[model samples]
Target: MAKHTTLKRGQLLKYIGKRWKNLNIISGNSFMKFLGYDGNGFADVWVEYQGRLLFLSIKEVELAV
Candidate 1:
């Protein structure tokens, strides 16, 4: 089951903008695809978007709608 999270939209953008490695959505996809990362230690699990910081669980990403 995916875990529902409620974070401000602005925070998500902040994490992406402030963090470079955190902005990587590719590694994240691979992890979500194959089930884990090779050695990059799963991409950013939390992000700031639109003045809100959204913390998401792995399950949530896998079940993202």
Candidate 2:
């Protein structure tokens, strides 16, 4: 089963200078700088990967490295 997480604002910030590959686990895909949590188990994350910008989810991601 895919692991899920409830990443807090502060915790999610840790991925700032990191790459999507650094994300231990991902449910959907991968960020930028401004992410908004809807308080309904979903979060919007922006990331710059492969010279492109990507929007990802929070609940569907896990960090275990």
Candidate 3:
């Protein structure tokens, strides 16, 4: 199998699942370290593709648990 590294923003993709809902991506995790967030928290969503990698909001995810 080969890997594809050509993902664009706002592109509707799907994941291989039968009992889980997908979230939207407010901002990408490629560079969250540079973009600091406030205490109030901002909108965060998960960006994934089938069996590929999944990227979500580290802030909201941590707070959720």
Give the root-mean-square deviation of each candidate in angstroms: 12.8, 8.6, 13.7
In candidate 2, stretches whose alpha carbon ends up further than 4 angstroms from where it belongs are: 1-42, 63-65
Candidate 1 segments whose C-alpha is farther than 4 A from its true place:
1-44, 62-65
Decoy 2 TM-score against native: 0.30
**TM of each candidate vs. truth:** 0.24, 0.30, 0.24
- Model 1 alpha-carbon miss at residue 55, Å: 1.4
Question: For candidate 3, what is the total of clashing residue pairs?
Answer: 0
Question: Model 1, 34-64: lDDT tens per residue?
Answer: 2222233444255333333455433444323
Best candidate, TM-score-wise? Answer: 2
Between prediction 1 and prediction 3, the one with superior lDDT is: 1
Tell me the lDDT of candidate 3: 0.33
Tens digit of per-residue lDDT, candidate 2, span 9-46: 43333232344564442333332233345455455554
* Model 1 weakest lDDT span, ten residues long: 9-18
Clash pairs, candidate 3, are none
Residues 1-65 of candidate 3 have per-residue lDDT tens digits of 01222333444433222233553334442221212222334333344333334544433333110
